[model samples]
Target: MSAVAHAQGHAGQGSQALAPADPLPITGGTFKPTADSLKTYQTPAWFRDAKFGIWAHWGPQAVPRSGDWYARFMYVPGHPHYAHHLKHYGHPSERGYKDILPLWKAEKFDPEALMDLYVAAGAKYFVSMGVHHDNFDLWKSRHHRWNALAMGPRRDIVGAWRDAARRRGMRFGVSEHLGASHNWFYPSHQYDQFWPKMGADYDGADPQYADLYHPKHDEPFKGNPDTWYTTDPAFHKIWFNRIRDLVDSYEPDLLYSDGGLPFGEVGRSLVAHYYNSSIAKHGGVDVVYNCKALGSGEFYPEACVQDVERGVMSGINPLPWQTDTSNGDWFFTDGDTYKTAPDVIRMLADIVSKNGNLLLNVALYPEGNLPPESQTLLSELAHWMGTNAEAIHGTRPWAVYGEGPTETTAGAFKESAAYTAQDIRFTTKGDALYAITLGEPRGRVTIAALGRNAGHERRAVQSVRLLGVAEPLQFQQTDAALVIDLPARMPTRHASAFRIAFGA
Candidate 1:
């Protein structure tokens, strides 16, 4: 459980130096539990059943649609966002992320109302921002001076969302992007690649914002030697301290680290503390710990989940994992376009079929409230979720996910060209099978993977019902596949779910 950074030493270079002390060992047991021990974590049947979760990428960063971490943007010189920053707020020397905090008035933010809409839209769980790389705590923090309570929204953002989500009978969680904050804010170097032509020494002369964007030193970046940022011990200590405060304060049921866990023994200790504390509360209640780079072969055996950013894995595994994405940019902008409801639904179906969950999706909005277009998309998703709740909410993958000509890679951040109507993702609930169509069929649909003539010869069509439709539809099994007559109009516009009952 050591948070040792994986070092790739050059031929001439000596081995990397170890941290002063070893990481705190994971307590209670050494044999990391597998999927069989999931019950010990108290991962509810509902969560395993509910394959989809929603994330609120909300933060002061959302106040500026220009990009993801405005904290880092202000530091790099001559980047597009840096120029944007210079145009809007003064230069990085005069105005910093700390200054932007006050402008983040969540005046239109209504957690209860928003949670109701999200749940109705089929989000079984909600993850509020605990802290991002900006180093600003979303909740009222006992340790951090920079937080939502003292400045910005002047409200306990995460606490309010947690309370609202719990009240709505939905699981509540918190996301911590603080792991990358240490290197991300490395004072001596401008880490952004977008401004390579501007040179790295641009921020060195800024004395006014030295504390906000720490002053750089002569040393090389510790994490990656070739990188510009330095992993100074003092800065790492501060990062760990802030994260410790976050874990102790919120005790979120699910904790998601932006990248991986922080970079040392301190990070391991923090993880151990989070797990142990959750166990102490609610009598050993299980919780999920999500991260991207868990380190090769260094997996958390205690029901911890891995998150793939903006992509789906090809092969299905019994272990539960998640995928985080957004409809558009992570931050909201005036002219930003968003994904249509159909696109979102299709993505969800494909992900579920691959045995993964979707998280960290935000319908970007300004002034802390969703726009009318985003609201319309959520309403459409709600309609789809209502009709296909059986297929989506509590289902497991069948023997084979489905028969489809199209393929989506299991790599990180992979995007699909387009899904054809012929593609169908499969999930199972009890004795019934749910075939989710990726897109609307032009006319007749046939699944080649199911086997031609096999549907009519061996598989009997017991009953076929289109999701969201009141009337049961008749279907005939042919040599190719089960073909059900479609209504003149689609039940739900985006992707449709069909509940096929089978004899036990």
Candidate 2:
């Protein structure tokens, strides 16, 4: 159906204020605000080959180091974060979130240094959080006055990230979680029922700051199913305008929405405008759009990239996809146990073998420097990537993902798994195949998938060499299995990679 028709069909579900508007007149290509037209869109080659990326999920919320959703969660009367806020920053009515904004100075923010570390850590792309559900824009947004330039830090956060990524020759991306802001921030407008001063109004209820706090919603969103996105047409239009400003200004290589394509027709129009704008700039589209809604069928086959949050696909996907995960919490939270380097390497190997990229979010502290643990993690990742990067970058999924005893649950928020030496993943480029061992094998390792006696016809295995190791692998390929002798000492502390060459 046409975009207008689709809008009409779903109009009853949302406010009547969201009637279809004229499509934005983009200069370059013939992209209409319709599902059929967007079906012609294709994934960029740059995105397919760039297997790993780094995301700075940094913002004012990191200031307290109280973890994700601190802005909204702090307002809930009995929540621990609320007590923390009360103890530290006074009551919500007096020194609420609006007062907390000035404290996020980002005094030590150095994008260039961070970008250099990310480059060494083998990130081909860098994504900056344009805004979070706190309703704070990190960029120099013309549409929203409550942005980085207008408030705390007094710097163009997105522009700085873009410049650094460009200097490092990495593709730039921006993630927008603003689509869910209206409902997410609804708690701010509420009065605490069980506080020291019962029923005292929070700063959000003040009409003077409604733009930043968002206009008050009558219904509370504590356990509401529709809290993810707002049905209010005014907020939808505001969302479109803000995101449109982001696209028109930054022209990032990738645009990621924290949720699905937002308010149907309006969202489609923004995406079409993004593609058309990219065509105007680069003469051909070198852009990618990612959203976290699976099986919606709202996205066409080649229209955009699919993103799994903190999870992986079960096997090789027909089209390229990405997994956006963080080392710890999405935002910086004090006393959180982070993923070890070995765990990260294992995840990367598994993700790459499944025709998917891993966009790792290295959580930055409010002061803008990495914690000691995070710094060490990056250093270890860089060391591992330094040796086995050839096996990852520009490689496609092999015939089989791998021969593994352990498999992660295939869905969002399922990043926890214990991988053994038996867990192996495969990727290929031309005649060379990469077999990555998730952990160090005790003795000789055997790959049953490459055996001549496999379920299907197997390729002839010619020779094998371990990446970063000077010595060649002692191996034999039989009809039963392909066995290789492992050395006494591991080349790296993390996952090991082997380049197995095949014969015609």
The TM-score values for the models, in the order shown, are 0.84, 0.93
| lDDT scores of the candidates, listed in order | 0.67, 0.83
Candidate 1 segments exceeding 4 Å error: 1-44, 187-233, 294-303, 449-459
lDDT of 2 at 130: 96
Clashes of 1: 10
Clashes of 2: 0
Q: Write the per-residue lDDT of candidate 2 for residues 1-504, one digit (tens) a residue.
A: 011112212111232224456654444367876778887888888998999999999999888888888888899888887988999998989999988888899999999999999999999999999998888999889888889998899999999999999988999999998876776687788897973679899889999989988998853334433345566778878988899888888889999987666776777788888998888778878899997653121445466788888889988899899999989888898999898889889999999999999999998999899988789989999999999999999999988899878968887767777998889999998889989988877778888887888863356887898888887889998888889998888777767888898777
Top candidate by lDDT: 2
Query: Which residue pairs of candidate 1 clash?
Result: 41-286, 49-393, 65-332, 187-214, 187-216, 188-216, 221-229, 313-410, 452-479, 453-479
